[model samples]
Target: MIEIFTDGASSGNPGPGGYGAILKAGSHYKELSGGFRKTTNNRMELLAVIKALEAIKKPNQTITIYSDSKYIIDAIEKKWVYGWIKKGFKDKKNKDLWLQLMEYFKLHQIRLVWVKGHAGHPENERCDELAVAAAKQPALPADLFFEAEAAREKLF
Candidate 1:
């Protein structure tokens, strides 16, 4: 089984943002993070999960994800995302990331467990540190997050 802990950080609601992910499999572990020029916390949260799933090399692996975002965990755990997908994601935000997530999710057996942020979970704490550091880094590039935001705007 693979375990992933993720966190997202933003300097401002629509300001510089980043996500951090820690993947553990047996005795091996990997840390991943990246910053965006402008984005939101929710987008960063979803992106963290996306990046972690993308990093997984093995197919059909049993994976457990720990996240602090109710926006993410509730959507999946409560089957709201499935309803959104069924309706073609109309009037919804982050459809692109959601679609991407569904694709990756289908490739692996995955479960999401929500954890309280800043509650001192070791991996979660490290993820927060990585996210904050990445957001503070200089010269970070723009992410597809803004593109998704633009697409949502066009729908309105």
Candidate 2:
């Protein structure tokens, strides 16, 4: 079984943001993270999970994911994402990330466990630190999807 702990951080709700993920299998561990100059916390949250899943080498693996974002956890666990997918993700915020995540669902047996943020969980804390540090990087790249969406929204 593989275990993953993830967290996301933003300097502001829709400001600079980043995601952190720690993957553990047997005696091996890996950490992943990236930053965006402009993005939402939820986007980072979802991206963390997607990146972690993409890191796995083998398909059909059993995986457990620990996340602090109820936005990501509840959406999957409560079957909301499935419904959204059926509806072609109409009125959805992060359609790109959600679609990317669902692609991994077919390859892995994934279980999502929500953990309280800043609750002293070691792996969770480490993820949080990684996310925050990434968000602070001097020259993060633009989140193209987010920028395009924001631009489109402004025209309305």
Number of the top candidate by lDDT? 2
- Candidates in order have lDDT scores of 0.90, 0.95
Candidate 1's C-alpha runs over 4 A off are: 145-148, 151-156
Write model 1 residue lDDT over 1-156, tens digit each, in one string.
Answer: 999999999999878998999999999999999988888788889989999999997799999999999999999999999999999988887788899989988899998999999998999999999998999899888877575677667898
Model 2: lDDT to the true structure = 0.95
Candidate 2 residue lDDT tens string, 24-135: 9999999999999999999999999999999998999999999999999899889999999899988889999999999999999999999999999999999999999999
Let me know the TM-score candidate 2 reaches against the reference structure: 0.98
Pairs that clash in candidate 1: none
Q: Give the TM-score of candidate 1.
A: 0.92
